[model samples]
Target: MSKSLRTLLNEIAACRHCVDNPDGTSLPHDPNPVLRADKSARIAICGQAPGTRVHSSGVPFTDPSGDRLRDWMGVSEEQFYDVQRIAIIPMGFCFPGLDEKGGDLPPRRECARLWHARLFPHLTRLDLILLVGNYAQKWHLGKERKSTLTETVRNWRQYLEMREGPGYMPLPHPSWRNNSWIKKNSWFEKDVLPRLKVEIKKRL
Candidate 1:
C-alpha cells in the first residue's frame, strides 16, 4: 500500500533532494521546504514556490501577496489559514533562490516530480484547487492550458464546470508586482471575484 499522508508529509519535511541530488543546480541556500497539507481541507491554494519573505517565515503566504489573495477570495486572515478548510500546496515546496535580476527563480522541478503526484492523491476531501500562477496552472492544467496566463484564467469557468474531479480555478499570482496587470484586467474583479467567492463560500 501507499504511505499515509502524514508519513508522506514527514518525508517531505526532511527532504534534501534539491540540495543533495538536485534537478540542475542545487538550491542556493539550505533547504526549507514550506507548504501545508491537511487531508480535511476542502480547498487547496495551489501556488508557485516560496519567495524570500515566505522562505524566512516558513509559513506560507505570510506576505503582502497573501493579503491580496485573501481579498480576492473575500476571506479573512483566520478563514484563509484554517487548516480544516483550506490547504496551501505550492508547486515547489522550497525557495528556489533568486536570479541575477533579484526576482525569485522558478519552482524546483524536483518538487513536483517527487511529491505532487504522490501528495494530491491523498487529499481525498479536496473539492477545489486554486491554480494561483503560471507554474501551477501549467502543471495542473497541462495540455488543456491556454497559450497564456490571461487566457487560462479568463477561461476559469470551464475548469470549474467539470463533471469529475475537484474544480480548478485559475488565478493570477497576487504579488505586488502584478498591480499593473490587475489594473489592466478590470473584468477579473468585475466578473471572476464574485464567482470565486461563491465557490469558496459553498465549500466552506
Candidate 2:
C-alpha cells in the first residue's frame, strides 16, 4: 500500500522543487539535495543546510563540523557514515547559497515543509534524534525550545525526557565558527556528551 523507504529516498533525490520553484517561485541556482537515511537507523542527525564542502561532496556532514560531531557522539567516521545506523537529514536539503555577510544562508523552509513528515515516518527504528543548530531546534521543539540556542542546549534533558517516541537532544552546531561557544560551555563536554554517548551506544 505504502511506498518503501528506498522509493521515497529516490523521490527525494529527484526533487527539484527548491531550484525549479521556491516559495511557489524559483531558486537562483541548481538544486543538489543532500541527505542519507535508512529504515534501520537508530539515530537521526537533523542539521542545518549543506555547506560548500558538503554541497560539492554531495555527502552530508563531510566537513570539519562532521569531525566534531563524531567526536561528540563518540563515533568514528565509519560508524557515522553508516546509513543503517544513522540518518543524516538537514532542515534544508540543499545549500541555500550565501548571505551578504559571506556566511551560508539559512535553510530554505520549503524543504522541511515538503519532505520531513514523509521521510521520518519511514525511519521505524529511530530511538534518538540530535537536533543540531537553531533551525532544527526551532522546527522540532517549537514553543518548547528555549529563547536562545545556548539555553535550549543546556536544557537538553527536558526534551529527552519529554519525547513521545524518538528521544530529542538539542545541540549547538559543530561548525568551527562555534569554537568559542564550545570553549565557553564547559558543562556540555563534561555532562551532556557523556549522556549522548551512552544513549548512542544503547541504540547501536
Candidate 3:
C-alpha cells in the first residue's frame, strides 16, 4: 500500500536535503521546508518557492502576495490557511535565497524532483489545482503548456477541459510586482476569476 499523505507530509517537513546536500554543497542558510497539506483537502495551491517573509514565517503565502492571492481566489484568510480545505505546496519547499538583482532566486529544482511525484498520488481527494506562476505551469502542464505565461493563462479553459478529474487553472503570481500585468490583462478579472471562484466553491 502507498504511504499515507500525512506520512509523506511529515517527511517533507523534516527534509533538509536542500540545505545539507544541495549539489554536494551546503546552502547559504538553514532549510525550512514550508508546505502544508491534508488528505481531506480538495483544492491544491501549487506555487513557487517561499519568499523571505514566508521563509521567516514558515507559513505559505503569508505576505501581501498572499493577500492578493486570497482575494483572487475569493477566499478569506481562514479559508486559505485551512489545510483540510486547501493544500499549499510550492515547486520548491524552501527559500532558494536571493539573486544578485535582489529578487528571489528561482526555486531549487531538487524539491519538486524529489517530492512532487510522491506526494501527488496520495492527494486523491483533490478536485482542483491552482497552478500559480510560470514555474508551476511549466512543471504541471509540461508540453501542453503554451509558450508564454500569458498564453498559457489565457487558455485556462483548455487545461480545465483537458483534465477529466481534478481541474487545473493557471494563474499569475500575486506579487505586487505583477500589478501591471494584472492591469494589462483585464479579462483575467472579468472572465477567469468568476470561473475560478465557482470551481473553488464546488470543492469547498
Candidate 4:
C-alpha cells in the first residue's frame, strides 16, 4: 500500500468507538464505520454498512453479497479485489450491530457525515460509481431516484440517460433479502443487468 493509504488504514484499524466495549459491557463492536480508498482507482462501488462477515475480515464485501455483486459486474475475484480497478466504500465502515428484525442494522449516521468528502477527493480517476442499495442511491442521486428502491433500480437507465461524468448507476443490494424484489422487478433482469455488465466490461 502507498504511504497515505497505509496511514489511513492504521487510523481505521485503531478506531474503537463501537469496537472497544473494553469494560466488558453488553454493548457491541461498532468501530470506524466506513472504508477508505486509494487515490488512483477508476471504478467505485458504494454499498451499505459492513455485515458481520465483512467486519470480522476487515475487508469490504467479503461475503455472499460481494459474491453476487461480482457476478452482476461480470468480474472475477481477482478483478473485483484489484483496488487499482475498483474501489469500495460502503456507507458504514464498521458493522452496525444488529436489527431487532433479524438482520444487520443500518449504518451509523455519523460515518457518512465524517468520511465521504475525504474519500471523494482520492478517487481522481473514478469513471463510474455503482450505488448499491437505497442508502447509496439516496445519498448520491437524491431526488433523481424513483418512488422506491425497486423503481429506482428499474429506472437505472434513466440515470444512465443523464450521460454525465458522475455516471451514476443505481442498483439493489445483492443481499438475499432482495430476491423477492428482484423477482417482482423483472425489467432489472431483462434490462439493467445486461447493461450493467456491458458497462462494467467497457470500463474494466
Candidate 5:
C-alpha cells in the first residue's frame, strides 16, 4: 500500500467520536474500515456494511453475495480484487451487527458523514461508481430519488439521461432477498443487465 493509503487507514482507525450514538456502541464495532483503493482505481463499488464473513476476514465481498456481484459485473476474481481497476467502498465501514429478526442491521449514520467527504477527494480518476443497495443510492442520488428504491431504480435513466462517460448506476444488493425483485422487474433483465455487461466489457 502507498503511504497516503496507509495514512488514511490509520486516520479512520484513530477516529473515536460517537457521531451516531455519542454514548458509544453497546457492542463495539470494528472502527478500522477498508474502503476503495490507493488512487488508481477506475471503478468504485459502493455497497452496504460488511457482512459477518467480510468483517472476520477483512476482505470485502468474500461470500456468496460477492459471487453474484462478480457475476453481475462480468468480472473474474482476479479483476475484482485488482484495486487499480475496481474499488470497494461500502456505505458503512464496519459490520453493524444483526437485527431482532436475525437479519443484518442497516449501516451507521456517522460513517458516510465522516469518511465520504474525505475519501471523495482521493478518487480523482473514478470513471464508474456502482451504487449498490439503497444506502449508496440515497447518498449519491439524494433529492433526485423517488419515494422508494424500486421507483428510483425504475427511473434510473433520469440519472444518465443528461450525462456522458461511465457514470453512476444504482443496483439492488445482490443478496438472496433481491432475487424476487429481480424477477419481478423484467426491465432489469431486458434493459439494465445487458447494458451493465457492455459497460463491464468496456472497462475490462
Candidate 6:
C-alpha cells in the first residue's frame, strides 16, 4: 500500500537535503518548505519558489502577485485558498535565497527531483494544472513547451486540448515586474484569462 498525502507532507516539511547535502552551496538559510494540497483538489497552481514576503509570512502567494493570480482566475481569496478545491504547489517548496541583486534564485532542483513524482500521484482528482512562469512550465510541459515563454503561453489552447492526463495552462508569473510583458501581450488578457476564469468556475 502507498503512504497517505499527510505522511508525504510531513516528510517534505522536515527535508534538509538542500542544507546537509547540497548540489553547490547549501541554502543560505534554514529551509521552511511551503506548499498546500489536498487529495480532493482538481486544480493545482505550480509556480516558482517563495519570495521574501512569502518566506516571512509562511503562506504561499501573500503578496501583490497572488492578487493578480486570483484576479486572473477570477476567484476570490476564500475560493483560491480552499485546499479541497485547489492545490498550491511550487517548483521549490522553500525560499531558495536571493542573489546579489536581491532577486530570488530559481527553485531548487531537488524539490521536483525528490518529491513531485511522489506527491502528484497522490492528487488523484487533479484535472487542471496552472503552470505559472517559466520554471513551472518547463518542468510540467517538458519538451512539449515552445522555446520561449511567450510562445508557449501564446499557444495555450493546444495544452488545454491535451488528451493524456491533466490539462496544463501556461502563464506568466504574476509579479509586478512583468507588468510590461503583460501590457505587450494583450492577447493573454483578452483571450486566456477568460478561459481560465471559466475553467476555475467549473471546478469550483
Name the top TM-score candidate: 6
Give the alpha carbon lDDT tens digit for every residue of 1-204 in model 1.
Answer: 135987998999999998999968999899998888788899999999999999999989999999999999989999998878898999999999999999999999989989999999888999899999999999998998999999998999999886789999999999988888889998898999999999999988
lDDT tens per residue, model 6, 1-204: 135889999999999999999888899999999899899899999999999889999899999999999999999999999999999999999999989999999999988999999999999999999999999999999999999999999999999889999999999999999999999999999999999999889999
Residue-wise C-alpha lDDT for candidate 3, range 1-204, written one tens digit per residue: 235766787888888887777865455688899988777899999999999999899999989999888988989999998988999989999998897899998889888999999988877898789999999999999999999999999999998887467879999999999889999999999999999998998888
**What's the candidate order when arranged by decreasing lDDT?**
6, 1, 2, 3, 5, 4
Residue-pair clashes per candidate: 0, 0, 0, 6, 0, 0
Candidate 2 Cα errors over 4 Å, as ranges: 1-3
- Window of ten residues with lowest summed lDDT in model 6: 1-10
Best by lDDT: 6
lDDT of candidates 1 onward, in order = 0.92, 0.90, 0.90, 0.78, 0.79, 0.94
Q: Which stretches of candidate 1 lie over 4 Å from their true place?
A: 1-3
RMSD per model, one decimal: 1.7, 1.8, 1.8, 3.4, 2.5, 1.4
Model 4: lDDT equals 0.78
What root-mean-square deviation over C-alphas does model 6 reach?
1.4
RMSD of 5: 2.5
lDDT of 2 by residue, 1-204 (tens): 136888888898889997777785465678888999888899999999998888899998888899889999999889998999999999999888887798998899999999999999999888899999999999999999999999999999999988488889999999889999989999999999999999988887
Alpha-carbon runs more than 4 Å astray in model 3: 1-3, 24-26
